[model samples]
Target: MTEDYAALVRDDRVHTMLYRDPAIFDDEMERIFKQAWIWVGHDSELPGANSFKTAHVGRQPVIVTRDKAGAVHVLLNRCRHRAASVCERKKGKASVFVCPYHGWSYDVDGGLRKVPFADGYREPVDKADHSLIALRTECYNGMIFATFDDAIMPLAEWLGPARKWIDLFMKQGAGFGVKTLGEHRFRFPGNWKIQLENTTDAYHFPIVHKTFLSSLDEDTENLMDVLGQGGWVEDLGNGHSVMVMIPDLIDLEENLDAPIPDRFAALAAELAAEGHDDDQVRRIVRAVGGSGFNLNLFPNVACSMAFFRVLRPVAVNETEIQHIAIGMDGGPEAANRARLRLHEHFQGPMGFGTPDDAEGWERVQRGAAAGDALWVMLNRGVDAPDGRPEPGHEAGDVSAETGMRAAYQMWKRMMTA
Candidate 1:
């Protein structure tokens, strides 16, 4: 019998089975991932014509390529002939992909270029019919997404209210434009939604990342106190949410004249010495620090403060995460260096934050095995101080579980549809 997904996901809690059930995970791969526009890659990753990168849309592997004509395409990685993967390198500029199994060649646009020993075929192989299977692809800002369901709504309409927050998040480019510098990929024994829940989860930040906060300078440590700040979380429609951790840093360009922080003071001086004016130095410095909010896009990707958090489900009890560090595309070297250093300090592989978060997610999965009927409580912000939302805060305070609740509701909607 098909499970009732709506019953499993309530307004304030979700069944533990949602995390531990293989059936539910498989259903999610088909219903949520295949039907929704899954984030595949960034425009910057495919720097120019003929560049490509490999990514996963749920469990199906796909190749994201920019053709010689500069158009982007997401094609099935498997060869049209023998099902062998046509290309395996992580990313690079490639004009043609040759399958190692049978030496079938394909173009950057996934058009079948040549088949080895074509004369051996009894029938003429139609190149148009044999090209790599392509999916419906779309991009917003620099984020690329693909979907198997061509009937689904356009990406922009699906994004809806989330676009505003995405625009603010991209302003970290500081007018130079945002580009991917690198990424850290790690796996933990836990459900993907656990890490998804972590994106907008402020309640666990202080407790889990205590060491990271302690490592920060005094002034910066105070600034990292996200829960105590007057910031709040808002439920952007379509299951997306934004957790504003530092209200003052919400719009990086708004406070260009603000005094530079003590930590960045030296960097600011360095930029000025490099011939940048006071205004340019301030803009670059502020951008290097990243935005103040974590915008969790539904299902797979998140703009988490300084980096992009992407989750891929390996199994019912396994999930792989990518913490993609972004920097100014053509900005000064010193500024990008500072941004990389800051990213390394907290979000890197050996950094203080990710390890702690992975531990917490693993523990949650371990504990889920203990009880068969227990529910994962998500009632933190169900009721406000006065039993009503604050003036501008319809979701809740910074530490609320409103974001997770929003995600599960969308999950229920998709799974039942």
Candidate 2:
């Protein structure tokens, strides 16, 4: 199945085996996830010099750490002796990581800092040679990513037009930038691709999230009705793409129940000092850091307005998803709490939106196990104009499968490379 993904993948749709085949899943781990720039975590997650987090780049365990000098590094978590993991913790501040197996110690910079019994060694064990394997790491706008393949393109070049959307999301906080509030994780009994495709799928909103949408007030419902009409999808180059809903739902002031965020006030004051008026401040706040964009970073990262979705593939039929709510760096505590509540409303395990989506994805997995379903149709908005210069209207446009197609195209390129 891995050998002939091109033959298996339909031009307009993909076969069910793509989701159920173990061989294809293995190939994906190697060809797609490892080769691409997989987002490890945000820089804010490890702000202190000794802060660190454990992440998986595809199936490979990785440690993302900041050295005493403040340089961030991504290294394989395996120990040199017997291949034991050097760090078992998920996240914490540590001066050094020691292999529980042989007490092989490594500094935060991934250099071999010490060895338990160096005098007993017969053959000379160079500390440099025994250090943890390092992967190519890069950061863009404070987002950290690592790749197994050093030949891969730089994050900036790979991001292309998608960088603009990232900038917009970053602009939410006055000048401090965005931070991950917290994450809710869950396993879906389905392939990772199923969830990735759903992120940009505007078609599913009215039907799948109908109950949640209906719960909103009349104005919000009107906006939902328009959203149900369909929206613009664009190919942001590389494997990145976007599915935008028009008029920027977050921009509407009808539901400003949350207290004004202190960051917003600070930004407003800064703008005022720079000679801006109240209306300009309001407009800036209304944008909600690019409230209109559902930006997708190819392979495994997605930033949907105020929240983030990180995809982790566990196996052929199982995927783990992490939903993170973002907040302003120094924003009002109340506003950040409101953002968390809003995230919980939709993305939490028992939330109004995620449960339904997870159910749908699980059903897809179950159905695909039959091995007879040949095509999962993705022909929605295949002929629509690609959203480019039109900005907000792109979110309202219906005929746009550009995002999905872009992802699949990248998949094909990587698989066949």
Candidate 3:
């Protein structure tokens, strides 16, 4: 019998089985993660030729590498023979990957370079045909994504309306290119969708992060009032969404004349003392503070206000989340340091925000054990709407569940296809 995945995901709610059933989880791994453009790494992560990093597309481990010609390849980590993993390091510059089990080696582009004891085989092996499997990889702006399905649309077309928002989010680079400084990775007892929904759920910000708010200065606290701001959540087609928490900070290049906030005042003074002009100082400070919106791209990645949030599903009840800190590629040291400090304050494992959010998501998975008949309600802001979105996009107030609904609809589409 068919699973009827569409029936499980309605316009306003999804069945709790989505967070508890291993069968549904397995289906999602094949349907969505394998079929969709899964974000693998950023341009800065590879840096130059031979740079590589380990990543996952669903449960399949893969290696993201940049070849000598600067071409990026997402190769299956397993060797062509005996299925031994060719690489194990998280990231580094590597010209070749040698399987530990055997001396079989592959080039940075996953071309099988050599095999030990080749004479033992009855027939001569074709190196070209024995190369590691490679996924279709493409990048937009500085973000890289890979997919197993060759027939799916290009990353840009799949991104659709979200591309504009991605361009806006990149403005935080402050004229310099964006670079991934580092990341905070942690595993939580929850479904990946729970973390996905939380990225755009402004309604939980104040309640769940009350202590984080209290730790901020009064002015900073006021600025962090996401729901009270004239903000809105827009569904940016193909499961992507953007939650604008501070409209004033939408364009980091705009409002050059605005006074620097208290938290950034000292940094601004340091920049000025370093001989930076007024305009340059303001621009750097604003970039360090990050953008005002969270761009939640479908499946596994999100540009969450100031950082890149990537989710990896481990099981029906386990998810690994990575909060990647980004900074200007060649920007001033002071500005980059300020960005790191800010990331540490809220996104670090012991930071004021992450622990609390992790606990909340864990509780959600724990609560799922209570019943199988309940649904995960996602009807917020449906009856009463307050703001308009972009011309072709669907939107709701800042605290709405519009983003979650958009994601679930996409989930249903892929699962039922």
As for candidate 2, its clashing pairs are 244-395, 381-399
List ranges where model 3 is wrong by over 4 Å.
Answer: 384-395
Q: Residues 57-105, candidate 3, lDDT per residue (tens digit)?
A: 9999999999888899999999998999988899999899999998899
Listed in order, each prediction's TM-score against the native is 0.97, 0.88, 0.97
Write one digit per residue (lDDT tens) for candidate 2, span 239-344: 6888777544423333344444553566556656766466545544554433655788898989786677899999989999999778778655544565677678
Rank the models by lDDT, top first: 3, 1, 2
lDDT of 3 at 130: 91
Which sequence of candidate numbers ranks them by TM-score, best first? 1, 3, 2
Error of 3 at 1 (Å): 6.2
